[model samples]
Target: MASSSSPPEEQYGTESTDNYETTCWGCGLRVMLPSGASIFKCGWCGAITNQNKKKREQKCFGWRVLRDRCFLSSVIIFMLFVIFGGVWAVYPIVFSISLLWGIFHSIITTILSIATVSFFSLAAFRCAGTPPNILWGSYPTVGQGDLENYTFCLYCSKPKSPRAHHCRSCGKCILDMDHHCPFIGNCVGAANHYSFVCFLISAVLSTIYVSIMSVYASLHIWPSLSYSLGRLKGMTGRDLAWRLMNEILIAFLRSTLFLSSRGLLLAYLFIASVSLQIGLSVLLWQQLSFIYQGKTYLSNLSSHADNEEEKKDCQNLVRFFGFQHPVSRFFSNFRVTQKRHDT
Candidate 1:
């Protein structure tokens, strides 16, 4: 039997009332109140709740700010890599090798790479700048019987729609939130999911093009590196070791000294391009998988399975991107639009 007159601690003696059961607002999981008795942090979704106020805090200022800055810096670094590694380094080396074909291919790849980067950068910026739609109060047309369809956000003190969630980083609730991406400095939601997807696809394509060009450049460098190693076969143990070390030193210098060896510049560009390609490819694959399954990264983390209504909602999202077919979605992702939805 539950005690009514006394506090929970008093009734239970040594047992603490701070361990009270509560529901996590973020992921709808059961969680225990913290030892302090004033806050409950959800381990699943990283949501922090005020036990006394029964609300989540709006802003997270400390590490989140630093993290956001780091992400922005990463974007800058990526741009630099594309400019220096792809344009200046690899393209020049290719041009020096075969003038006509190299110039033609380099120009085409560089233009395409630049266009993709520009489009995605614009999309990411636009998505980050856009604000989320928040429902403030009850609808006049919604009868009392339909109240269960809506949920209230304790933090925002507003009515939350079916797919909406509170973003601690953004300090508000986001409608149909996919995930909060620090890399883009925004929450991926219904308003920006299209842009986010477009950015991913563009990034993937750009990286792929760079990777192919990088491989071609790398093939030219392999002969030089192989020749250096092949010269040590007839040398004795001590002489072989000394020669090997000297060859490695020369190779390192050749790769690092930009003005001296084209091989080094090509090698550097190849590694960077291939690495970016692999990373972007994996990310694109994940995004595509989520789209095909009609789920966002956040929804997946919360174990939200799609029903008929959610499937319908997903169809609406696809249509919003001006895409009716999967094949067309890739090509038309960068088409800018002013369409906005309040729901």
Candidate 2:
């Protein structure tokens, strides 16, 4: 058992009868002392530890997690992609270029995403358990001294977990806690970290694909609408085509009512709108799918409280990936504190 404060009687030193023996958590040095030994003086390495008990206790943030105003604006851009992209896809008929455009954009975006996620994932993993103050170098935190500890979480309390921080947002210690992105709308923790990367890969591609498709669909619609108007004015098919394609202007006086006998460009409109709509629909649904699964910015690492759920999530994730590494079980957990350090 770890020593706690000695009883009131042992304020300074009691009688010689009150001695207890315990192993040092700091350096494994066996220490024999009074019942009230609150601190351990390690003879081997000269490290001071909370000898009273068995062991003692101990933001890569601010760069990426932007202001609410900037963040909310980014969310708006994504929303517009959904709304307009859907309308455009489901409408008119477009050329084969739409296919190439979507595919090309998706692939390029996916590559970029892969690069980004890879960098952060590897960096955070390497840096886990390192305090942010040391990680970021000297900076003003809300300007608290014991607040030095505020830079890094006490990891359930590990020496340091780089990129790891106590997410007041998450209200738990997180491993490799990157900014909780509300856009994808999830905290980027170690457990769901890969998934967040995957989401970024898929999402950027999906959005770009929808964008090109939306543009193509819109192109087909308005031009066809113009073509129909020309045809309604009793222009010949060839003439109407030229006018709609902006090649020629066919002016014809129908009845004074100005009702043009333009046929509906139903084919182009229907096809383009449908295609754009389908792509957008998929993108939006998948984003929600990611969030619903609780797979977003960070991989959802199980916390101390998530004993059952975290265990399940960890097992499921590891199994799904088919990795059999044992280090996952032992190294992933955080200790409440590290042994106190001395100069």
Candidate 3:
């Protein structure tokens, strides 16, 4: 453990020409600092020490876990409802339309359902990346620059790497943490980040497919709507548009009164899927854009705080997906190597 010169006054001490000594957490050696300097970097091991950082009590930790569990349960239930309810309501109409079409749609639904659920489970249930264990606190074991930019995690009582962030909800430090998602009941860190992105993609696609199918099913079962043609005859420009929209709205409202149980369910599914699709599409776009900039959500926020410019490059995206270079470049290099070998 690092030792401060003055346990209480070191943090609140006044500035002076004098100097004080504090122990570095990395090398466990005393380091001298100017008076009133609350933050300093160790010259020996390059570890950063911030006197202002203090551990806070994790109040209501159980309550946070409970809240996350509740949210997770709600998400699971909603997914189940969408899957079973949509199938029950939409399948009959789809089958009635054409045998081959029904089978094709069933296959699509199976694929989307499997993909969405698998990705979701991987993202939610898997560990969200723990920081690697390293030897510290001893001068003999720790070497120069071994703990560069490292800070002591008061809660974990351990050295936290620069890339790690403490997640109160997770009760631990997560390496490359993006954010803690209540819906997933987990942190979006290095281990689960790929899964989380995949889940978002699959979810968005599933919602789009569900919305389209729901609309298609509704079209087959929708009750006839009565609209007056006289309303459009005397209208033009904005007036025409407003009048047309109003008439359609009125007709749809009136037709809904005659909708069967299946039609009503189809309408609900369509609305839900479209809403989820829009929200999830935006989230996916934001995630991809951050990846393209070689940043995670948390890192992006930190960069904004530090007024750092983002490095936007396609190579970041390629590296994130585990590619060293573009496929064309990779193949070109391979071909050149093959030619050299032949010669």
Q: List per-prediction Cα lDDT, in the order shown.
A: 0.62, 0.43, 0.87
Better of 1 and 3 by lDDT: 3
Deviation in Å, model 3, residue 92 alpha carbon: 1.4
The digit string of per-residue lDDT tens for model 1 on 56-150 reads 44456667867976887898687776666666657666777888978798677767666666655664565433333432222233322233334
TM-scores of the models, in the order given: 0.61, 0.31, 0.86
Report the C-alpha displacement of residue 239, candidate 1, in angstroms: 21
In what order do the candidates fall by TM-score, top score first? Answer: 3, 1, 2
Q: What does the lDDT read for residue 260 in candidate 2?
A: 20
lDDT score, candidate 3, position 117:
93
- Give one digit per residue, the lDDT tens place, for model 2 in 1-343: 2322222443322235777766533333345567666765434323345523432222423433444335646655644544444434433244245766556655654564455445434423332222333222122211112222222233334323323556543345556564555444345555655555454555445445445654555444433312235343767778766666553333221221243211122233334445645664675455444444544334444354333332324444454345776554555442212222321
Better of 1 and 2 by lDDT: 1
lDDT of 3 by residue, 223-256 (tens): 9999996858967899899889999999999999
The residue ranges of model 1 lying beyond 4 angstroms of the native Cα positions read 1-53, 97-103, 127-148, 218-262, 303-321, 325-343
Ordered list by lDDT, greatest first? 3, 1, 2
| Cα-lDDT of candidate 3 | 0.87
